[model samples]
Target: MTAPTPAAGAPDRAAPPGRPDGTERARGIRGVQPVAPLLGVLALGVCLVTSLDVVTAAVALGIEVALLPLLRIPPRTLLLRTSPVLVAVPLTAISIALYGRPSGRHWFDLGPAHVTDGSLTLALATALRVLAVGLPAVVLFIRVDPTDLADGLAQLLRLPARFVLGALAAVRMMTLLGEDWRQLGMARRARGVADTGRLRRGATMAFALLVLALRRATTLAVAMESRGFGAPGRRTWARTARFAGPEWAMVGVLVGIGVVSISVAVCAGTWRA
Candidate 1:
């Protein structure tokens, strides 16, 4: 009996030729990814444990930021300078204060609610924990080129290609959103229906952007169907994705963070007891 031939069109399994990051900025970004796996790991841990022992997570973040040069991601594009994360930081804090744990001593009772020192402490811990976890994911992913990340995730974690491939395609098309936005703005101005007041203008701009996005999305769907992107066949990778030194280093960093953070929490508990 003849062995069944491997399915046609599977992506190549061999590691591809490597390229070096020559830009100082890219170097810094690349450096961060090694630590990013760690930061992201610790952040996930803190979220699960919800404890104040975030020294490990903080340390992981610090290392990742310091090594940011190695990730080869641009600071501006990588969410290093994004406003959303900054906004999230404070919002996390507020959430803790409003809905955090109830405490032993009630400072005040506002009918069905009591505010206490314990709740305050819990809120603080919760806020810190959230930021510690979320920041790294955002940082790592923002700077990460979608294609590279999809490649890494697929090869290292063995994720199904369909989803990752779809995400990659989506990201590749995101660039067009900006151009569409510009055109939509021009069109709105031409129609004389655009808002002039600051409050209305901002809202109008958001609505306009959303409409432009929806239209592009429709166009993209039609384009994909026409191009046979969804056809069943072996796909080829233009760039080789490998989980070598960088990936291992990242995992090691994460494990190290888990050890350190949990250890500190244990020590602190013992001290209190």
Candidate 2:
């Protein structure tokens, strides 16, 4: 007999050849392994942290700015995500300028704070460094899926499967917290208990959320244990986490940026320990 046809309303199961399914495509940055961006960020951080000079940070920041277009992030989303870094850079600069080791000609002096030429320079370098490091990290992790990251950690990096899976579960559960909080608030409002004593109401809601989270965690742990998640046998993955050319290239670019930034700082006699 001929093969049977699918049900009339059955969803299409076969993805187009050489193209990712909807779920994989939604994870973003197709063809680049999840671990690649993580490794790139780590390499960049290591390179940038070695120097406390303006030249190094400025160079890295400039390079990052030039490469932003390649990330393909929408302008609005980028701004919204990077807003924390933007706010933090100025605050960090101000703090460093006021309290960082005082040297050179003093610009301002207060009871226990001083702003000097040296501190000013340091502040500027620090601001740029924060922007350089924080911006790329924020952007790179924007579309990272918890499951994908866990897969990468376990398969690509050879991390402990139990730990990776546990952390992945925690991350997945954390996303539900926002919805839980909203539901709790609505429930409390319906009972007419959230209209007054804002601080007390918040504390009560938080305690309730904590209890719920604990219960959920306990249930999840039991379910996972029952499912052989913590078994001693070698674990297998559903999806292979590949570290290929694109991943390597991504890492190389970040490392190269770091190296060039440090080299410029050293050559310019602005390098610091």
Against the true structure, candidate 1 has what lDDT? 0.60
Reference-based TM-score of each model? 0.66, 0.89
Worst 10 residues of 2 by lDDT: 17-26
Clashing pairs in 2: none
| Model 2 lDDT per residue over 146-214, tens place | 777888999999999999999999998999999999999999999989899999999999999999999
Q: Model 1 RMSD to the real structure?
A: 10.1
Q: All models: lDDT? A: 0.60, 0.90
Give the distance in Å from residue 24's predicted Cα in candidate 1 to where it truly belongs.
13
After best superposition, candidate 1 residue 57: deviation in angstroms?
Answer: 6.4
